[model samples]
Target: MTTLRRPEIGSTPEPLDLSFPAMPDRLGEVRRQLREWLSRCGIGADRAYDVVLAVSEACSNSVEHGYRHGGGLVRLSGVVTATQLLIKVTDHGEWKSRDEPSDPRRGRGLQLMAALVSDAVVTSDADGTEVEFRIPLDPRLSS
Candidate 1:
């Protein structure tokens, strides 16, 4: 088993933390709960939805590829700055990038993530895979 360590962001970031079993059926609930959490915390609805979508994509990838639908853990954490919301999803599995025409169409999650979030980062090494997404959390949220 591999252990993944989550680095601490800067102090200017507000942290919202959550963890869930890597199950397909639970993904929707995760998104919904995150949405509510952000809303109650005074995050803008638009930015919250963007974060939810990006997180959903990342978690889905974990369920479909990281754990291969068997079982694993997905950790979702958010760091909100005055102008950005940084979300990180860590999975206890390795990432295998595909690069062939015949490659299973199973690798577009990152593409979708890139399109939905302001910034998307994937770090996969000996420890595990961690994907981070950022959403602008400017004064719009406090409006």
Candidate 2:
């Protein structure tokens, strides 16, 4: 597990860092922590909802696709800056490539994430896969 560092008093809060087993059951806890952290950063309800949804999609993909052979760890980290909130979901598992989803109702996680955030990027290699989201913050609320 990653140990989160405490921020200095009166300074910007530390980024949210979480490391957990990459399982479907852990998603609720991830969502809860993310919601709380974004709320503390003064993110409004609507935008926060989008942020959570987008981040969740990334985490879900990590859980579903990253570990084809066995289980691994998933790391979620978020940093809020004056202009944007940057969130990354990383998994330590072999990367799998699929041409298409076997089910017609699935495989849209990437699209949904991209639509919900200012920017979304996915990178994968032999070691693992990582998804990053950059969400613009409201200038008025970022202060």
Candidate 3:
């Protein structure tokens, strides 16, 4: 389990940094820890939900698509400023191209992420794939 440092109210919290094995079972733990960290940072439940959902999709993508043969690591990190929250989910696996045929019912993770956040970007290379999300903060929460 990853330990998160609680932040003082009305102050920018320390950047969130967590790394775990890229396995399906670990996602629940990741979501739990992330929710706790966001709550401690004073993020409202509604906004926190959006962040959590988006990040979860990214992690799911890393686990499902990033690693095709064996297990790897997924790193989830974030920073909160007065204006917005920035998050990155990274996996150390070969990048998978969308040009390849994918499940018809799936592949909407990117779209879901985009709808939930102000900005969502994905980048990949031989080393890995990273999905970054930027979600604007609510005025009341940033104060």
Candidate 4:
């Protein structure tokens, strides 16, 4: 599917579309790919790091909580526009809580995502969970 946002300069940077197995080991590779692309797109180092971290956390949640019956697909898709960096991490399995996480770590992923971005939304239903983050780019660039 085509990405919604248009980059301010030039035509637009091609969206990064990835579908990988719902496994933990793949996350590092995903972050690496995103970091390279973001840097190439003129994203500053600090913002790139925050985006990578938030995306990694979302992907980790998909593999750890979203899949249950068997292995599934985790889809990462989005593009960085002039105004914002928008990414979505979606899993094909419904979220099922396994056990309470440690006190210090609980809810930190979601919190960090929201703190880093203008908006962070996590939606879970029968199909699966989708964690979407929209981070304003220019503001971070100036800060």
CA lDDT scores, all candidates in order: 0.69, 0.78, 0.80, 0.76
What TM-score do all the candidates reach, one by one? Answer: 0.77, 0.86, 0.87, 0.80
Cα lDDT tens digits, model 1, 33-104, are 788766655655665666678789988887766887378788888765556556788998765556535357
- Reference-based lDDT, residue 70, model 4: 77
RMSD after Cα superposition, model 4: 5.1
Runs off by more than 4 Å, candidate 1: 1-14, 100-106
Which candidate, 3 or 4, would have the higher TM-score against the true structure? 3
Worst lDDT run of 10 residues, candidate 3, spans 1-10
Q: Which candidate number maximizes TM-score?
A: 3
For candidate 4, write residues 1-143 as lDDT tens digits: 11122234674568989999998889899999988877666666776777788789889888877775679999999877677777899987977553645566475777777766647899887778999887665533332
RMSD of 3: 5.1
Q: Can you tell me which runs of candidate 2 are displaced by over 4 Å?
A: 1-11, 141-143
User: In terms of lDDT, which candidate is stronger, 1 or 3?
Assistant: 3
Off by over 4 Å in 3: 1-10, 140-143
lDDT, residue 88, model 2: 94
| Residue range with the least summed lDDT across 10 consecutive positions in model 2 | 1-10
lDDT of 3 at 128: 90
